[model samples]
Target: MHNILSVSELSKTYDSRFQALKRINLDIRRGEIFALLGPNGAGKTTLISIICGIVKASEGSVRVDGHDIVADYRAARAMIGLVPQELTTDAFESVWATVSFSRGLFGKPANPAYIEKILRELSLWNKKDSKIITLSGGMKRRLLIAKALSHEPEILFLDEPTAGVDVNLRRDMWQLVRSLQATGVTIILTTHYIDEAEEMADRIGVISKGEIILVDEKAELMRKLGKKQMTLQLQTTLERIPPALAAYQLELASDGNELIYTFDAQGERTGIVALLKELNDADIVFKDLHTTQSSLEDIFVSLVKEEK
Candidate 1:
């Protein structure tokens, strides 16, 4: 796959001696939704800001579609569109007017048809004549996205696109993102929502303390670090684990009615046969057994904690 955006040895340092970003290197594949995951102040915004030319990097470089952000800033910026976390729009401007004006800002010729399509896609067509202030909070967020797409950018960067939005609007925005992906628009988003990353991202990138800690396909990441738990419903209560089962990592749960055995999914063997044999020897009877895999949220939390 071809990469639309590339960052090499990117670093950012503020005057206050704060290092916002370390030696970061990343490549965003063409037409893939890449999610950057991190806690607050983890340089998610700073990385996007540098790529979009909103904030200058202290070191290293960024290239958008083969155009260096610094040397060929115009060409690079023209290939990208950014929907900021903040909602800053003209209060009195009509929806149509605001969207149309955004297109002109990118040196794009006026295209009423294109503007209309975006509004209709975002379900903002009915409010075309309504002033921005008259619209709801959700509408304002949608309008920001409209303005970002008004210029028909090839690569769209969404910064916490669903933050502070309601459930319905969040679902709507996710649908909108999928629609854009269908049109071959590359999307890179930074979000605190782990499930959003799990559901939408083609690849996940984890950053912490000004460093790029990990990046991999969502499924692969899960498999490599994922653990599974097998829960057994005991037929009778037991005072403690037998010495024969002490070799295995197990926990008693459900008030001693359940026994939980945890093992790595990526391991060569789950040791179920050994555990069953040992249980039989100990006269332990399980009426039911069920298994569960670790979720993305669990993996994310563990990674962050390990990094910290």
Candidate 2:
């Protein structure tokens, strides 16, 4: 569980008026998939840019494997691979040539075997001879990944890697990320897809207004913040909740045909049994009852709203 990256009191401001990041502190563990979730203009990409040395921080410091990103730019940059949200590549260059050029940029000795492995893993081997402009959108995205991985970085930064891709391609990207993790590579990704974060991340961080609101283990975050709702279809119309059942915090539906009970999902006892018994005592009967669990999207929205 070694820390592969650390950021202390990181802040960023542009044009001396707009602050893009705010006092962010984080530690990314080795071989872990950490997902950063936020709305557009929430600084997810700004934070990534600063960490990758694409943008300078207004204050504080960052270290990649103990190498200062600012002071040891070469070593720090060399240890990281970035797949940006935008798809920009040499249009006329062959896929293989472009990826090889990327490795060369890092001053790494030519390793054809490693390059071949990366292309095959990304399903770009067949198109290695094809020009970048000739490939399909999905193939171009895969080529972006192959190029990022060309240098054999210990950490990979994926900024909306699956954005604009089809479902099958997105799934393939997820599998590729898993395979990369198997090789002991640490991954940090910024994504708009909450389900993707829920499915792939070991830990999740929510950011808003250039500030990190919460960071926690994905399951623990869900359990701590998640809420459950029970909807009961009343057999008869009720104008309002009974005074006796008010303690359960029940909400009467507008149509007067349902009662909704909201409660914490992580509670040791949901008190549903007691509520049901009390309902029976009050002569309140329901025709049907259904329950639903809160999703990651729900928790994320709640967190961001609270920050505002």
Candidate 3:
């Protein structure tokens, strides 16, 4: 995993009063889907804006493909494609024309074949001649992606790419992202959809209050923070946890129909065997039993709350 983008002690303060981003340090690996997760106003957008030259950083530095973002603006900006959260585009311009214009903005020569390929890849070929204002919300989102990729950038930044899209469109966008990754394009996306990150990201970074709280491989993060719960359908209703099973820290359901035992999924011993043995000793019987693994959403919420 090569570091294609590097941020060292990056800080952004407005009017020397509001710190939008704390001293943030990050390394975005080449050819990987890195998901940035944060709550609203957590500086996710601010960080991406600085990297894409949309916003100026108050202090520190950012390097895109070993080129300083500010000192080597052309080279750095050329290697990155930013799909902003806002859907601001020339309403009268056709999809094909708009995307082609974006390529020209990067000082790249016109390449009709490349533009055609990008349009087809995003399923925008049929709508290529259609005015931007006439396209559906989903098509507009796809057009944004096409515009970003027009210049053939090495890194693609998707800022809430699927934010307002329908479920089918969102799934299509995920498939499109996967296709882009297959072509060796590194992707860094900031999304409110935790499940989307869990499904698409190779690595996950959690940011809170402008500071990065954790960064880990998606699977590794799940293993480290994920928990498992053993749910027991009790044969008889109980008002509270039995005194005999106090050591296990069992939880009694509100309806008194289930007993829940939670433990770390990565633990050497889950203590289920001991817990069941104790239940047997106490002559407590269960009608049914089931186990469930914690989701990435659970881990994300827990991490953010802990940071707060």
TM-score against native, each model:
0.96, 0.96, 0.96
Candidate 3 residues lying further than 4 Å off, grouped into runs, are: 268-270
Q: Residue 13 in model 1: shift from native, Å?
A: 0.3
User: Where does model 1 exceed 4 Å of error?
Assistant: none
Candidate 2: list runs displaced more than 4 Å.
268-270
Residue-level lDDT of model 2, residues 1-308, one tens digit each, is 89999999999999999999989999999999999999999999999999999999999999999999999999999999999977687799999999999999999999999999989888889998999989999998888888889999999999999998999999999999999999999999999999999999999999999998899999999889999899999999999888999888999999999999888865526579888989999899999999998999999998888888
Residue pairs with colliding backbones in model 2 are none
- Score candidate 2 by TM-score against the native: 0.96
The digit string of per-residue lDDT tens for model 1 on 137-180 reads 89899999999999999999999999998888888889999999
> Model 3, 226-293: lDDT tens per residue?
99998999999888777989998889999998999998865526498889899999878899999999
Best by lDDT: 3
User: Positional deviation of 10 in candidate 3, in angstroms?
Assistant: 0.4
The CA lDDT of each predicted structure is: 0.92, 0.93, 0.94
Q: Which residue pairs collide, candidate 3?
A: none
